[model samples]
Target: MNRFQAMAQIMAILCEGDRIRKGSQKYKIARKLIAAKIDRMGPEAAYSKAKWNKYELFVEIEELLKAEKAGKILRNYI
Candidate 1:
């Protein structure tokens, strides 16, 4: 998959882990770690500008899952 698709997969995995680990401090810390990884992958300014859009993130997650189910290796998205 392409860079955007890969990153979306990583983010979706992180989100799932966060949901599974809810109510623990580890989940909060993992979220920050995932956010930092994403920030490092792209232009920080652009990422910061779009980071508040939850709907976009959700859509990206859906796309990522589709990619994953199609037998695409998406670990590079991280």
Candidate 2:
């Protein structure tokens, strides 16, 4: 699959809410990261026609986990 599709799938799987509640700060953080990556790679139109480079554009699942953990900690402080 292409980067966009892969990204969507990954987000769907990992996005089980943050440390606190559903659709909390972690969800927003994940969405922002996804959006930024998509924007960096151009636009949605390119996702379909763009040549696959062994699925390189998508963020690693572990990274998202780490982001969620960090966000949780930050949320506790804030």
Candidate 3:
């Protein structure tokens, strides 16, 4: 995968790991670090793409977990 995709995957994995460990604060800290890295990279589209990728990845993982929880509820009722 390309740099942006790689970063997204890395961030997604980190987010999932944090969730497993019940580390909400750490996850927020990681997001801030990602934002800072993006800022340090400069205000170009190329740099911004990585930042966006990280945000999207976080959202995707969060949605996945939500869906999983919903599925579990459905399974219990069905």
TM-score of each: 0.38, 0.36, 0.33
CA-RMSD of model 3? 11.2
Ranking by TM-score: 1, 2, 3
Q: Candidate 2: minimum summed lDDT over ten consecutive residues — where?
A: 49-58
The residue pairs that clash in candidate 3, if any, are none
Write candidate 2's Cα lDDT for 7-75 as tens digits.
Answer: 565456444343223366555655555555556654453343223422332343235557566664433
For 1-78, candidate 1 gives per-residue lDDT tens digits of: 444554455445545635425544444443444455556655443244335554455454555556666777656553
Clashes by residue pair, model 1: 6-77
Go through the candidates in order and give the C-alpha RMSD of each one to the true structure. 9.7, 8.4, 11.2
lDDT of 3 by residue, 1-78 (tens): 444554454456555534524355445444444445444553354345544575564554465456555564322221
lDDT of 1 at 17: 36
**Least lDDT summed over 10 consecutive residues: which range in candidate 1?**
25-34
lDDT of each: 0.49, 0.47, 0.48
Which residue runs does candidate 2 get wrong by more than 4 Å?
1-7, 16-21, 42-78
Top candidate, metric TM-score:
1
